[model samples]
Target: MPVRPADIDLAQRLADAAGAVIRPYFRRPAGLETKADQSPVTRADREAEEAMRRLLDAERSGDGIIGEEYGEKPGVTGRRWILDPIDGTRSFTAGRAIFGTLIALVEDGWPVLGVIDQPVQRERWLGVAGQPTLFNGGPTRTRACPALRGAIVATTSPHLFAEGDVPHYMALVTAASGGAPRQGPVYGGDCYNYGLLASGHLDIVCESGLKLYDFAALAPVVEGAGGRMCDWNGDPLTADSAGHVLAIGDPARTDEVLEALRGAVDDGIAHDH
Candidate 1:
């Protein structure tokens, strides 16, 4: 059967519910807690997940839900909803505007609907499995940068990227060729940067130390907008495990960027280990 396009009405509804849950908590203190990894969390994360779950049951009653806070719940629909209620909890807790909500509808493990709502940013980005992305309900796609010399890249933790992520980071820096690659370390919004890439505002976004919820929503958005997103080995992403993602408007150019980054990171890892 043709995958066709995912249901937009359903996609928007899910994104909206997540956004609605976070609206009141935007910049409001939600009381933070420390996870086992010492990462920050807040009531907003938990509350947002709960609210989304309720809507999922009512709207797509049979769909399985995989969330950040509550983990996976029983669902019967062939489609699975992968969500990160508040991706940038650290930023959210600190009252930064970089945080946003990520949701993706996956059919048989492939994301066919991706929605990224940056409520505080007042931007709602979404796209179904085989279509272009929409920003605020308008058509959108990544900007083309033919060469790596001038690509601009974003990453969450540059310093921590040194250990295992060195190859991926190095590939990015070299791919820039001559274009300036800027790094202003900002935490949270793992999916937002991919949204930015889909909108033609960014060249690449790298991620490591991510869970399925962290990258699921983002994979579809970036890919839907005429870009390619995958782990370091060039595998398509799913809602699981920690891996590296290289997102760019053009695949050929992105591959060039990837090769350069891989070499650089390989050298760095070789030196360190």
Candidate 2:
């Protein structure tokens, strides 16, 4: 049976699984390793997935689970739990308070319950498709910025940033609606930036080099607040495809920006292909 939207507790328990893994890591030095992609991997990341998998099997026995560290377990039932145990591995490995645990439920291939748990920040953001989003149970809405001018867009480069793609990304950011112009250089705060998008504190987050678990749990919270999450071409996100994610409030502003991005990325791809 499909869990009802009122079953927020189910989602809550899943988020708690991540906290369980982090608790022990917080007590000792992080046992970190590297992925083939050159990204940090930690015991907390793997243990969190293993823990979450166990609960999902015990609680929602018939449902499937698609995880980042672990792959998928096709279920007799159609419901699936999509998890990113730690969305910001770099920050987590550094013991910084920026990464988050993402837990979401999808039924018939559509996201129904989404939880973005930032344990370090002591905030857990939750959303159901038709309900108001909550920042620790208080209702929240996206910021109603008058225009894109002065709107701040946040993003990060986990690895591919320095491979000469920076110039194109910078050009698009420079050409967006409006921006503050005082920096000799720039940087961003990673997955915490997505929390800003959920809070409406920022305008957009454009990213690539992502995996399914990286973006799955984020789509609902962003979309629930009247924002949008899409691939580089404005397509919907999927549990299997994590090519790109864009969080933007203003569609006109986003369409304007993404069109340029597609052109630039396409041009680069054409040269390489």
Candidate 3:
């Protein structure tokens, strides 16, 4: 189904609402708490999501909601809104401006619209399927990276990767650097990296252990900006996709990135055998 202009407007409104609730809490003591997973959460995270949810409750009640903070609310419409109020809580706590609010509208499992909002910087990237991505309402495109050797790869952190997934990430990094370490993978940007990639500042971003809310909004932004986002196996992202994600700014480099990851997995399997 085609996304309506009104829906796109609503998405920006959702981002606006969340940003309002988050700004006052940034850099100030916001009553932090740790989730069971040992991840940090603050009042900004909860209230930002709440503010967005309240808007959805009033404007698009029929749309399902999958939020990082309050859990899920199923709706009758085949569409759902996936939200991550703060993609990098640690960064936010550290007073970094890289944290972002992610909003995605998925229809029947496929993301039709996505928004990456950085409240502090007041920068927003909006992407609708089949349309060019927009950064701050201006059309943006990913930069052309001729080869993996020159690609600028990024990830939130190496420690976030599971032990089994580490080798695959390392292999991609090694390949991206052409086997000689010359400025290792850029680390720690969370969703901001995707926005940068959309605006042509980044080349690739690979991550593991992400959740639906973490990545559901990222694919459209990356792809609409002349990039490609997929699983490590090279499949398009869906609601049911595994957490492993690879974002390549240049579409031509997809196979090279996938092969690097595949080679690592293959080597691991051979070693186990």
What's the TM-score of each model vs. the native? Answer: 0.87, 0.86, 0.96
The models' CA-based lDDT, in order, is 0.73, 0.72, 0.91
Can you tell me which runs of candidate 1 are displaced by over 4 Å?
A: 1-6, 159-162, 174-189, 239-242, 265-273
RMSD of 2: 3.3
TM-score: which is higher, 2 or 3? 3
Candidate 2, residue 129: lDDT: 74
Candidate 3 lDDT by residue in tens digits, 1-273: 899999999999999999999999989999999999999999999999999999999999998999999999999999999999999999999999999999999998999899999999999999999899999989999999988996899999979976688888888899988876775789999999999998999899999889999999999899999999988878899998878888899999998998888777655411110
lDDT by residue (109-167, candidate 2, tens digit) is 77777888887667888878777778888876667655555566677663555354565
Q: Pick the lDDT winner.
A: 3
Better of 2 and 3 by lDDT: 3
- Top candidate when judged by TM-score against the true structure: 3
lDDT of 1 by residue, 1-273 (tens): 234444577667767777777878877778889988677888888888888888878877777888988888867767788888888887777777777788877877777777788877779888777677788989888888877666777776665453566555755665563433353323345667878889888887776666777777787778878889877666777644345566766776756765665576335322210
The clash count of every prediction, one per candidate, is 20, 1, 0
